[model samples]
Target: MDQFEVMSELYSDRSNWVDVRRYPSTVTCRRMLRLADFAAADPARWGSCRMAFEVPELSYRELAVARGVSHTTIMRHLAKAEVGDAGDFTARELDGECPEWLRAVSIRFEAGCTSRTYRYAVALCTFAAAQPERWRVLRLAYECPELSQEELAEVAGVSQPTVCRYLQPVRLEVDESFNDLEVIY
Candidate 1:
């Protein structure tokens, strides 16, 4: 099927609106949560925004009904949330340009941010996206969370230590950022 046809079928049923493939990685999911928290300033919309992503199997109408709002309201919240903007950032990063959104997601920790964990997730994801090898490892790890470091190493055609090495920097960065945030607070 062509892309247009696929999209049409995908959207024809509001009840079946969400497709897991749209979110390809944990990094993307984290970015969506971060964006939702930032853009949906209204607490109600913020909850809707989170539901829209977290419960990917739920349709807009389903989400709206669950939230006791109109489906259009859920749609508006997601539109304002810019959940799809992560793809654009990934595309720009792939094209060798550092996107502004990436910088904002990775660098900024504002009052609107939902949690320290999300900030660290986006920052680590941003760091992974900056390097090709690290990106592959990160993607693989997220896709197969059940896999061990040794298994990931085998999949990536490297040693277990190398897999650990690929992820160590992100771990360290998260730890450092926690300390940084603690000091600032």
Candidate 2:
């Protein structure tokens, strides 16, 4: 009845009745698209570099190998891509970094992020990771998607008048240089 045995039993059978959360890959992909759009909005990010070049984890060497370019060209491309602080590197943006606790939760969400350690922190992180449009939608929806306006207000911990506040547009703002990520919204 302890945790280990429960997990072990669950793992032993393909047909175990235990619940497995399903990810809407489309939603994730759409969110990524939206994030890309947001990143692109900064004119500084424009360059010959493709999306692959700005990816957080890819090193200059890896990029060079992938593009069949010299390391210098890779570095140059990364600079042109405006990915931020090419001299330093961090895997996740500060505003999108989930706590170690939530790392496991992201796995449950099937999102390859740290949600188990962060819980709702993960949700906020993902929201921050999204594009402006996606962020607007997610912020409002998380306040309370299923509730009446009054109820939604309570859920969002805001005044009822604020439920409709979601319609007001807000721009997405990532919190730090991509190189030294710390925490998500």
Candidate 3:
């Protein structure tokens, strides 16, 4: 859940305080103190729209990258925030469904590696999807006709079988590493 959603839920309850954008400057200090007191008493209301308190102008990418979190995570925050007619937030899904080429490798990885998840694989795919340039580097050997298995594995950050899956044209194969995720291809 985005932190804002958490805030909104908290603010749903009643809070008592003057909504003072109209208070007299002669007593601005008093109103400010009262406002502070009100906020302290109802942290949830303050949290729900914390962004509104500051410059309050964060683009989607800026918000995600600044926080070092996924864009999807940011969207969840915004969606839950439900800020003024703000758009929608849908999480991308990348789970299970191993490529046909890795079937064999999936088996091999099982023998000596720890368990991993399709979610993990999809996370990698999500990373790749989010950053296209990175994909070019990872998939470099696919265009090279003379590279050997070790060379492909080195570039792919995975085992030879994992590379072999990439080498195949029709379907991605798995050996045994479905659980380990140690192999990177």
Work out the TM-score per prediction. Answer: 0.30, 0.24, 0.22
TM-score, candidate 1, is: 0.30
User: What is the lDDT, from 0 to 100, of the residue 175 in candidate 2?
Assistant: 26
Across residues 1-185, which tens digit of lDDT does each residue of candidate 3 receive? 23233222222212212355432232222222233233343343333224332224667677667666677765654443222112322121123353323322311112233223222222333333343333433446645757787986776577877666645543323324335324433
**Model 1 misplaced stretches (Cα beyond 4 Å):** 1-40, 81-116, 119-185
**Clashing residue pair totals per candidate (backbone < 3 A):** 0, 16, 31
Ranking by TM-score: 1, 2, 3
Which of the predicted structures, 1 or 2, would earn the higher TM-score when compared with the native? Answer: 1
Cα lDDT of candidate 2 equals: 0.38
lDDT of 3 at 97: 54
Best of the candidates, TM-score: 1
TM-score of candidate 3 on Cα atoms, chains taken together: 0.22
> Across residues 1-185, which tens digit of lDDT does each residue of candidate 1 receive?
21111122222212211366533344344453343234323556556644554356788888988999997788777663233343443454577784444343212223242244444433443443345465677678877999999999999888898889887644325433333322222
Q: Which candidate tops lDDT?
A: 1
RMSD (Cα, Å) for all candidates, in order, is 18.6, 16.1, 25.7
Compared with the true structure, all predictions reach lDDT values of 0.50, 0.38, 0.38
